[model samples]
Target: MKLRCELLLACGLFLALVLIFWSEALPEDRTLFLRDLSAEIIPVRSFWVRSGGFALWNPYSFFGMPYSANPQNQAFYPFNLFYYFFGAERGLVFYIIFHHFLFVFTLYWALREMGFQREGSFLGAIGFSFGGFFCSLSMLVAVLSTLIWFPLIIIFLIRAGKSHWLKPGLGIGLLIALQVFAGEMEIAGISWLLSLFAILFLPEDIRGHLSVRRIFLALGLGIFFGAILSAFQWLITLEFIPLSNRASGFGLVDALLWSIEPFQLKSFVIPNYILPASRLSLSTSAFWGLGFFSEYSYFLSLYSGIIVLLLALFSMGGVRSWKIWFWVLLAGFALAMSMGNTLPVYKFFYFHIPFFNLFRFPSKFLFLFYFALMMLAVYGWQRIQHKPRRIFGFGVLIIGIGLLLYLIFSRLNLEDSSLGAELIAHKFFLRSSLRVLAFFCLGLGLIFLLGSNMRFWLSAGLGVLCFLDLFFAHRYLNPVIKRDFYRGNSYVQEFNNQKRSLVYPPRIASLSAPSEELSFQWLTDPIELYSRLRDGLENYWSTYFGIADLRAYSLFCLSEVSELGKLLAEDSLSPGVRRLALARSGVEYIYYRDYGFVNLSLSYPRALILYQAKIVKDREQIFRIFSDANFPGLRSVLIEAEDKVAGDKNFAPMSDFARVISYENEKVVIDAEARADGWLLLLDSYYPGWRAFVDGKEVRIYRANGFFRAVKIPAGRHRVIFNYFPESFTRGLLISGIGFFLWLFLFGISFKMGKGRK
Candidate 1:
């Protein structure tokens, strides 16, 4: 009966998620494709599908990058099997829905494991999963996927510590590996930090049963095993990091971007109260925050429901148990740290802590604060069941607070007429506060009138109320678009037919300053803007259409490629200089919103044979040479001084011809005829792990033209092939295989032991 009830509840939760996202649940409807989804993930997934299997290289973006090594690609995540079986479009919707259900179910399971009643656990799960943070971040596939494992990790860590068993430890290890594969290492790091806290400050009952030394050993071993399991993903990521834009970590100020302001705390109680004027604008303009709306607006609706806050406060009133205080303290710590520069604590951690500088957005710490609140609310529910009469007092106090804020804001009068916008914002706040008060009264009435004996009915009513609260508040966050949004674009079709490299305007041209109200008009109606941009082939739409774009969006780019892009985008450089640089990089078309695709007159072929070579010792010198208007980039190549190139350096001009026979994601083939010994330069981003073969014999690849690949060509026609097969991936695969078997063996032992004991 208990198992049946739990299963029913799980089904109910899944159904609720589907209903909340009913528009997106349709086969033709999709979430808005604005940031990472359109620019990075969809295009990469489309390439992977077109390549017929898992591929290592993404030649369409960043001029050829390691696709598997890019963490955000999520190349090895097990859940991506859905994308493989069903196509990228439909599969992404199912993938997101599945993870959201997993989040709610896992949190409920974790709360039950922590000794909460089923009713309370269910309430806590609903509040947290449908809360502001999780709901708003649903569009961010990687972050949402990585965070679903948090509750599971906490549960297994506690189980392992208490049981002193290898099975749960192995489970934790596998969970950790899955998170690493999910492609958001920052969230994975936060999970580990929270798990550490959960174990260190466990409730007295569980802590008393644990052997401290054994628990620590289990945790360390589990972490080590997890590292071994995910060695392939992280090992290549480590190699790529130093070459990436974030090689040296962010500056202190940059790292503090998106820190929650002190005034934003009101968001915890009032919906749409953070930057109320911007919320009223129904767009991203006038966002008076530390970072842009795309970065900070996701977590704006921090209202987890008025009943949740009231119950949590009620739990804090009496001399609570140590477990209750544990959650309270953790919540306080997370709230303070989320203030970033507003508080001194985060600054100290940013300078002193090891990995704190690697990530921006201290507001991410609110995940912990919200998690702690969910736990506290569960405890509060348990207390309220016994002292049911006290609920009305707490509910009245919350309503009174909301009314007080509403009165205060309503009474504020500004003598200066310039505060008109501020007055409108205050009015919005007052309206939202009234809405919160109504919900508070409704929740209080449900609990008080139903009484304690009617547990099932009371729980059902409150569940519906909480769902409505969160649904109405955040339903518009990730709006749905028709499937036709991605298809039938003439620009995409045109680019696909050309099958050549393209260059678009830099991202800065599209970004609007916070003060630019007219510029932000497009943001007010994102669907219309997205539709217009689709016809213009904005962002990485070229990649999705199988067109190689010189400028594409990525979390990080190779330092050399980044510098090259900066030079190309610089207004200080002449258009001729920029065109010359683009021609050398094999850019055949340039996209402009007003003019559409324009053909470049001096575009270089993808493969070229240069008769002359110049060895430059300094990298900057190569850029300087390229910046000059008179440099003959078509005939002469610049080779790095450190790279050794065989053959004649001063070869006379010959009838040398090179043509690309085949170009694929991971491999490229060129048929070349060199009448005299010269150099073959391929305008592809050069990095480690790419090997060249001439007539089935291995040849050295040299860094040419600052950040492209080059190899020596003999005085005969030869077939040259370039393949990307890194040794790190092979070695990591072997280690992961071993770890997999070890985990299986541990599971066997655990199962047998339990069977024997039974």
Candidate 2:
């Protein structure tokens, strides 16, 4: 009966969510992240997979980043295949909501398996799932997929404490493999780290009951098998990371950029009490001199909702176990980790821990606090025995005191210059306080009447209260898009509408900012989300329209692109020098995406697209032209092997008769008439896995202009083509296949041995 009730409520929750997501298209003002990152990539990925093409080389953004190796790609995850059935664009909401329910069920089952009854486990499910962690990362599909696997891994580990090294160990292995394959390694790493910690600190009584040696051996085997299964993804990622911007290491300043402010920590009591609410984004043009907290860290500010918070606090009263204290200490330490600069403990980890410096945003460690909150909340609920009236009275006393203090604070409209963001903070605090008071009162009434009854209905009401608290918080924290919100934008659809007349695979850019409003305090934090919105729109629109956006946003950028971006942002050169440099670099157009009313108007936006200069193809002589920044004489295209071009007697220098034949995501073809020996240089970012062919025969491809690609063309009208074939992906696939077979063979042998022994 308990099981039936939990399952029914879970389904009801999922169905209610679906009504919001599936009935209509997302709204236009929906975050650029949803449209640009998630929607844009999934469709392209599904197309390639369904067509049996190589799931690599995304040509849409950053001069084509490695699709499968990119952590957020979701190309290799099995569950994504299920979502792809509904079509990538339309099915995204389903995927998100699916994971949410999966998280709830997994947490409930895991706790129940650990000896908690339906009530305790259900409260925990509500605490973790609907408490705003997943909601904050709503568009982060891969991360959520990875996160849901975490509880299942713990469940398996718990089983392994009693079982032999075969079944439960394999189960653990399978879950880890699934998580790593889901794309986000950072989230996966955190889960495994937390898992190891939990196992290391298993309660002494439980350890004694299971025998410590058996627990250790099973866990070790499980992790080993899991590592083997996920070797493909990790192998590719390991190879790529050294070449990425994260290779060298980020500084301490960068690590603390989005760290949580200690003052905002009161959000645990009232989720909406955040000082400068993200929903209240105000433009600097309007409020340039005000104080506010415009920095966007992990949302929810560690809010576990008022009901859960109180329940968790209440559950804390009767526990005297030393093991419990250890967990509580760990929780406090985790919270400290979220305070990047405030605590400086992460700095210790940054310097001491391997690969720790490679990551940014230490505030994400809030996951630890979240885990601990659920654990303690369950403990608190379990302690509330048949004497419900006493606890109910205590709860009312607390609420009454809190409400009285809030009333006094509300009456006092104190303002001071040093009190940064206080005005908005107080207003939000007052509203959230009222909500908490109402809920606390309602909870007291429910406990007084039904807490003693101990019926399933009591648990159901508590679950409903959780739903209401989280849903209300979601209103301001992370809102979803409307049904009509997802239709193609006018700016993006322009290329498709005017397809016939435009240049083939025309390079485009979006100079307009993302139209995000900024608050006064945003000036201190340099995330510059508003300014970077143009980046999201540019990549999304360009990818969908089959256009090359010269300005690419990537995890790792080419040195040349870095230089170019630096030059552009700094405006370092004289006007003549700038134009001359750009002309030689094959720059064609500067585009401005019209983002309706919110767009920032630039004075000289035309300068981005207007480049007209002479093209010279001389493999050996181009260095002289680039030696001087202001040199206007004879602009030459730099080629990788000038000596090779000189050695080729038949090499034809082509400049006057270069024409684009065709361009696709994986292939590019051009027709050029060469009057003399030379190399055809393309000013595009170059990476591994690209092959060049002249007409029917394969030719040598070389790097040119520091970061572009070049090919040797013979002295005639020749057809030259470039194709992408990533060896890493191909090799990784083979390795994964081998690993899969190896695991199967091991499992088979283990099963046979067990049966024979029995």
Candidate 3:
């Protein structure tokens, strides 16, 4: 019977996803076109495939940075084999669907293990997997990928505590490791905290004869094992973070940037009541939220389901088990934390908690809140079986109060009575409130009218209604476009064909257009607006077209490269500085939104040999030299004072030349000749791992021009090769291999012990 229920639940989840995203699932030509999908994920995955299915470096973005080391790329994630097998477009569709299924099914399994009946467990699973917080994450694929494992980790920890078994603890470690590989460390950290809470505070029955010492031991094992298992990725990330722009943790104000506004809580019941009348529209002009529209607009509808909220409230009333109250408290905690700066609790946590300052978007804590609410709702459903009339009364009272409040607010005039937008918002709120009340009435009627003995039919009917409620509210959040939308544009193709570096206009310049004009264009014709946006070749769009971009979007960037980018954007500096910086970075073409790609006629060679170098102890001196209008950046180079190179500053190299013979993602080979000793300069971002070889002999690479690599060269023709081989990756791989073997050994022991017990 349990096996049959599991199979049915799986089928229901698959069918729901198909119905919700039919265009993406059934059609070969349609695909999702949400924010990060195009801006970062698809391009990175495509680049990984283009680099022979595994890449250690990405030469296309930020003037070449570590590809595999960027956790967002998910370089070592096992599930990415789908991309390797089916390509990015189809694989992404499958990846999203699979993770959604995983989320629902894992929640169902966990609830069942906690002794909830199949019907109640199914309700909770549906409520959460289709909840506001989870649905809002559709655009953030990495966050969703990491978040799906939260329930599984909690359940495994519970099992390990109950059984005092090494195998279950090891299993939890593996799940945590998978979450880390999913490429959202912030979500993983959040999941770990929630899992710890579950094992430590869960009600006695749910914990199942737990021992305090044993539970702590299991949690410790899981943490230690998970750390070692994911060392390969995290080790490299730790080494890279200090060098990147996010070296220091975020400040409280920055961390609270996306906190849920207290007024926005109405969304949990009324669904986008704060937005304009056409709340379903994707236009940014329609959003009037606290933060950037793009961030909050995707979650316009935070309504999980009217019935789910009602049942959760019902669970809170009446004499309940400690289990139910525990969920209530947990939900309250999550809600308080999600309020961020609006509440004192979040401020306390920010100052006192470790790793709390590392992540932004305090609203993400809603994931835990929704999960707890779903659990309470499940318990309420079970209780309703015996007291259906009581729950019906409670639902009527709640809906009655909600409708009364809606009537009052709809007629009340705002302080800005003349503002037409406020009137439109009021209209939207009234319309949305009516819809929510109608759904609430129908759900209440379902519980009141259905016969007590007709259990399966009642659960199935309510489940369908809940699914429809969430689907209608949030379906438009993820818009689909033609699969070929990713095909390179004419300008992108032309730049790629030329095999030359391209630089886009500064970010501030791109946004300099008047807000009204941008909104008008977006409303009148979004497709044309998108074309204009793409023409700039911003973000990883250039990477998708196989063109290197000097300006690109990334979560982590080398501090030196970021400093150079700032110089390029400084209007106060001489235009010559911008031109010189672009030329030194080997940019042959510059892209402007108004005018397409313009040729830089005096672009410097990508690889060059210089006989003269200035060793500067202060970084400001290098910047000053770069700022000089007459600085000969191409013929001479600035080296850091600590770097000692075997090159003579007075040795004027006659007819010196260097050119790149081969360039791959991880390795570059250059052929050079000089009449006298010189330094070979490669216009790629200088990082810690790259090793330079002169005629198969090792040579130290020095920081050139603040953010480029240079190696000393002899006075004769020779081949110089630069290879990336970071020690962190090597050490991490060894540690992960050991973790894998230890996990396997523990699994074998557990299996034998189970057989003996049987």
Candidate 4:
């Protein structure tokens, strides 16, 4: 009977949530991430076209792309690639659903791991799913996806708490790896939270259970493994990985703005409200500064503020374990609340610290506060062991109802009241069922507190509530929210409304065309480009943030024009540091896109179209047209070769340096210098694999480091030759050595520790 009841409630809640998401269109404001993910995957598609290689991709694309070189491109930072490559149609919808499932499962597992009753786990999941963070991020697919990892990390930490050093070390390592795949900002924030929790939560005896030395060793091995494994591909792609970017963090005032909660809730039944005339926004014009608030009216700062306050109260007056959580939540809340202010503590922590440049958007730490609050709520409910006297219970319920009614009818203006009333019908049955359910829960809790005899009933009732909250009505809401909120702002709508000119790094397209101004006028107006631009940078900004560019009106939004122009010029430069500027007058080729908001629209082809637009009639013949914006037309190719050894007797003069072994299908090899220290042999090809040897001795060199490759010989010179293949063997051996040693070290110590314990 108990099992059946549990199943019915869980099923009901799950169904409701699914319905809400399905009915609602994907939310628009946060939907940029889905679009961005789609944009980043274009290169992978291009890779398939060029090499037919479908291996798991890192952040870098091998085809002379910037993502391969720039650290900011961070792997999976472009998430939608997997969606579009695997599921061309409805890929985003499917991905969002998958995230919803992950959120539910992870929440369930995390609560269970924390030793909550089955029902407690269920309610905890429900509360978190509907928490302000998820609700706001649901509209943002990439951020939501990244956020899901937090629960799994908590689960691992709980499980690890019971184990020896190695197990926990490995668990923490895996969590770190997952965060890295999500990108650096996420990894940093999550790592900080975990470290803070570890210091606060883990008992000293348990930590001492494994000697500090062994624990440190295990942690070291885990970090070493994690670093190499997660970054190996990145290391190989760019030849090295960097720790920081030149651009990171906000000014004190800017960060403070992020810290302030823009929304607050006065009463639960009514929607949350924003204070337009508050300190954060002294006037309507001041509030409109960012264009974010002006463009979107659905900011939920009020709701967030209310939920946080309730959570704070719920967390107070708890046992040892609960108190730890309370303090952690308080710390997070304080940090979030200080985002825009210039407190000495925040300034010292964020600005004065050396590596603080690694993090941006300190305000996003609110995610930690949100999670803490959800867990505290669960703990509070678990602690509620007494029932009010019958008269008191009825009176309290009446008071709650009365307060809700008064707020709904009197405090709220007509428009707000009408809005709340409309939602009243939408949730009337579910809310009614919950009220009745709450009474039952209260009775059982009171019974449990009074006598141990009713323990089973308490557990049973808790389980039932869990089912009702998580698995039933929530699932049904999915469809409704998806239709109403998610789908309403199609990329087309955004495209039609924006008036920003974009400044993209120079590609073959940009070089072949002149400037963005001509490109926007001919190919896409500002409004149309707006939606496409959001899609392009969606995944990019999940970890890497910048303000939107508004170059179309000869205006700037979040970017500095001179700096951007410099970056463009640098990218368009040759290895020799010479600038290669594209035609600037006129061009007469038109590349039309049927899908105005597709990935192809954001690809190099669109940039090229605008580039070609800058060309005049004279340069028209130099450029052709590409239907897919991602596949830009090749305008002109430049080739230059030089033999560095001119004066030395490194075999011959520049003309006498002949191609030794040439393969049309792959690459060409040349026999040249067999000299020493300064004797350089340059075998330049577009494809990979070129190695040089001197007198049967292999000379190893790092490709794309300080130099591509250099061979040393006696000043007089001997025999020198270069071989061309796909990859160099030296890099492969080094990678193998690192992996093998790391594995052996971790396992060896773990085995020794096990023996010692035994």
Candidate 5:
């Protein structure tokens, strides 16, 4: 009953902190409304709309990307069934809240064996929950969701030492499946590996009670069955991994792309080194000299809290034993691994490890590093209350050290003079920095008032300190978004109405810039990140208006297509560049709207629709024509003697006067009236999944016009149809269904056999 009360009160406090931390989020104000939202969330939202039907292909993004193959979108995760009902914006908030709860719950459950008091348990849970990784990267829903399952599985692994097969085995398998289903495969993979490590390296005390052979058998089944349970998502990802854009493979340098930089190690002392400008307080400018964008420049802070750090360090101060050394080694390993190419150790792992070769972004391991710090904090607070000198002396030292950082960073010159206002308003950062350190100092100062028996205030003060620090960190950690960020141009409304009146395969393509949302690009540096989805969101808007789009932000940008985009970025490029990019994308009608918020313009691509296709020379000559400034426009498209060029105001150019019969994701029907045996070109992306049929007979679909689908039609008005039937998705689904039931059967048989023996 006491434990339950403590949990309820702790939950209330945690939720309040959540509300305060995310106070900026409001209706229609998308939280983290850029990269993660656009690339991962919105695309999944778009996928959800068509997935109920047989749409394995997304004809909107990047001239039609493979919807099912893009594993990051995470549409297939089970949590979506409940959360998605709230809509994307609200669903994200709910997900963040729910995962925070899970984080606390799992940590508390795992700590039960150590026999910490109620207050100690509560503090450990909150401290771990409020760690810098959680505060900074909570916006990444998949990572947050995937992370909570680690502790939960650890709790189950702790139970794995028991001789009974059902409890530990069922818990491990179910929790592992949940983690895998949470949609961050890389993180989930690490969690499973860690769980296996724990299972194999059972504590000596617990190992004594268990039969080694039985334990091994049960643990093996647990892992194997867990894989089967998540076979649905796993099988599809396995198929996608080799062919993904990363399939070109990651070189050592590429693996270090998001590695924690050497300078960023200062984040251990100075948090918020990578916060977005919007999250900065006015005082941040005074300390601005210390700031730098090493990599993504967001979601990398791992300073749990100053007081928390003091307590964690003190917890290990009294020990020089195996337990402490074990943590030191593990913590050092995580940090070194996060260093990527900066350390030779990571390079060795990249080449020697199988999954390590797949993805980059090494700094993501900070979450694990932060967990290690929390373990020390739990032990420190548990022991430090009895040691008064350590608390008082450590508190004073933290307070005094603020002057050193201030002196070092305050003298630096400004790169951007405009940022000086922040320093001026906040008294050149002196007042704010002292106040931040003072928060920790005050929590520490409260320690002197503690007597030997009054442990409650000491615990309560520390718990409140953790919350205060997290509130301070994340208040700016989360960017405040507004309606203006997403709400743009009346063009979407006009295009929405235009889409209803358009012919079959009503796919829209931008003729000039990738999107009208390019205005947001100027905020990011020579390279854009943490907000690359500005263009992706624009494409999502087109999909929201129920129109298929040609330009979409995709990770799987084909090399040829990526080069085309780069060529178009230069103002010196000809109008032919736009024509070539759009022509191959099956764009019949172009939407060209540009608002002069900046000098940026994407108002040219759609205008190419007016340039009728004419026969030109071969592929080599086409590139030559594009290079020449004096060369002609869309006329360059006519390459071969057999090449046919035709499209109308409505954009469907199946042959010449191709009337639309019907258009669906599964199939498209067109009535063509071609003169002689001219080829009928469908300006949709070419994928092996699509099959072509003419007048009810199967015909071959050829990759034509660089990246589009084209079919040869005999002269007549016979109907031509194209349908999507991706073999990979179908095969994966069948295997997953069989595997799921097979897991059920095996688990039931084992469970019954164990009961009979009992």
Candidate 6:
């Protein structure tokens, strides 16, 4: 009953903090939420809505494009789904609230285990829930949600610390399971490794409680859970190792250093006018320097340094034990070392240390340090209480005086600088002053915490602190916020609108296969498509660089299509003997509203000469269009519609078009009109050896482009013949067969080994 009460208080306090902070920052993102809302509405679950049909089954490319482009790999599956069921506007509101809940829940549990008073624990939960780390992560829906379950895992670890035997192993296993489910494996690996180190730092009595059997059991369970969790990724990896060699470190380094620069603190006092390169950078710097507690100059910004210094000074006093101080310092040192330019020999103690190289963004680990600082500040309050209950009143007065002076000076400086009174009045004083005042009140409440044992005051105080800190500090701390992180840039938003702007000038031309219009609706729910249609198209788009479509970015750049051949060959093609190229034409064609936002170019062989290429190429009255059937022989149509609407637009029903059935051993058929139209049948060199005829006349099959194994048919109805040579699909079939057998063999072996061990 007592534990349950404590939990309730913690939850209540956390909610209060979230409400306060959220009221200030909830609608901070205008564009991203709208984009996500738009995605939610897209019926054709496609990353790129080129032509909405099942004609090209390339779903892998859909998901892969986004993952490769952005590091925001944490999926917003639930949020996307939420919007699907609920209306977008209400769905997004629920998502924000839910994430807040998760953020607080994890913290409450972790803090409770750290020996904080229930109220203090609640406060800690609130603080972290609305902390810079949470806000920074929240910029991307996926990353934020992925991290929410992490603290819960850590809480279990703390619990396991109670008994190291069987429970700890089970705890470790549970952590692994949660991490797998969360889909933030790399970050989880780093956190788990840190947790293990922390476990080792426990007192000897606690350490002694652990045994080899327990450790082994925990490890075994972890492996078991990991296998179960990662089975799907493993299965796909059998096709080709899904290993990403791109170092996350440089991006991590850039993300880390970017926030710490002196300019961000100024922006905090000012407005979004002073933009930084990235949000992660800004938030990281805020955590390091102008944190909630101190005021000291860092590379010239005394605001952050001063805050950190004050907190550190407060921590100098001892509470019940010296271990807390030691742990805080240890955590700080770990963060500094990890961020610095040195080989992390200490990291090698874990099995996944080398694997950490895959993710270069080390700054993300600062979250652990941030957690430590919050606890340490509370520790400071706890420590001062030991001096005497009588001194509490005086201490509260002094703390209050100090806070007042800082705010006054900060406000004065803001007004005096070129930062401007109008801006300062609106952006800083009006927007941020209330949060600072609330935080000041929290410090006063902490004094009460020292004097009395009342759980309510402590909870209330902590809640206030969490609210003020997050609400006041995020603008300075998160670059994502400053750069309109969720809103997306100008062009991306434009792409989301269903109607294309004819700014340059042009008219929409109707085609035989009218292209699907890109809609404005996707602006609110871009990831909606990822949820509904699994096999149709890739969905989900974000400005966060690591997990969106690179093709999306290409909208800003223009390059010759032929130049792409070399890159595609190098990156995607197998060890072909030689001569990579693309066919001049295809069996299918695509049309676009304009160059519009789609800038990705198709590759074709140099051997194929361009007869004519025009921006608004037209067959008759159609504009800005492309076609598989040129001004020549064309017959027979097969349209696979990913969306039923696509069939309605482009494809004629089977009854409307002619169908060629296999007649004799010769597998040859032709449409009589093909010859007169002067449309020639062109085959790719990779195509199987074959002969062709039109209206009983022998025609040469010319190999033009290397990529397209195409047979051109004349305008009007024409018969087509295709004979599949045995060698064509041989390697593909062989590879697939071998892979299937090997998977079975491995499964059997693993099963037998497990049985034998048992």
Structural similarity to truth (TM-score) of each candidate: 0.87, 0.80, 0.88, 0.54, 0.78, 0.54
Higher-TM-score candidate among 2 and 5? 2
Model 5, range 32-143, lDDT digits (tens) per residue? 4544564456445645644562245665565565665555555566666534576555566666666776677667666653345666666777776776677655667777
lDDT of 4 at 654: 21
Q: Which residue window of length 10 is worst by lDDT in model 5?
A: 602-611
Better of 2 and 6 by TM-score: 2
Off by over 4 Å in 2: 1-54, 199-227, 273-295, 390-427, 444-458, 483-492, 500-504, 512-541, 555-560, 569-572, 575-585, 594-635, 640-656, 695-697, 717-719, 750-758
In order, what is each prediction's RMSD in angstroms?
5.3, 6.8, 5.2, 12.9, 6.9, 13.8
- Residues 1-758 of candidate 6: C-alpha lDDT, one tens digit per residue: 48778677657756765565445335534222322333322221222222212111111221112221222322223344544454333344456667777767766776555555655555555555555556555443444555666666555555544444334444455446445534555566656665554445444455566443444455555545544444433332222222222322223344234223223334323222211212323222212221222221121111221122233346676443555756677666655534433434223422244444444344455556655665665555444443224356456646655765665565433224465434443543343444354355445536554454544554454455545455556533322122132343344345445333311111111111112223212111212222221111123332121112212221101121122324334443432211111112221112122322332233221111121112121212220112222411122212211222111123221112223333222242433233222223222222223456555544544322222223334445555553322232234335445544544565566456547756
Scored by CA lDDT, what does every candidate get?
0.71, 0.59, 0.71, 0.38, 0.58, 0.38
- Candidate 6 stretches greater than 4 Å from native: 24-80, 87-93, 158-175, 202-216, 234-315, 319-322, 337-356, 387-459, 475-550, 553-758
Off by over 4 Å in 3: 3-25, 199-204, 211-213, 273-301, 385-428, 451-453, 500-532, 570-572, 643-655
lDDT of 6 at 290: 18
Model 3 lDDT per residue over 521-614, tens place? 2123333444444565556766776767766648577677668767777777777667766776677766765665777656767788887887
Residue 87, candidate 5: Cα error in Å is 1.9
Worst 10 residues of 3 by lDDT: 502-511
For 1-758, candidate 2 gives per-residue lDDT tens digits of 67667668755765565344323334333332232333355445444544354465665454455566555665567777644576454456566667776777777777765666678787888767777565665555666778888878777777667666567677777887888877766777788778656555554545554545655666677677777777766666666666566667787887777687877676666665322222234432212112223234455335677677767776567645665676687779888888877887888899899978876776677778788777777776766665457566566756755764665566532233344444545555666668677677666656655664564766776677776677666543433333333344565465446654644444444464533432224332212332234324444445544555655454444334455555545455665555454545443444554442122222111101111122336522344445347443222344454343433222222245366666555677777776655566654556776788888788877655544666766667788888876566567667768878877887898789779868
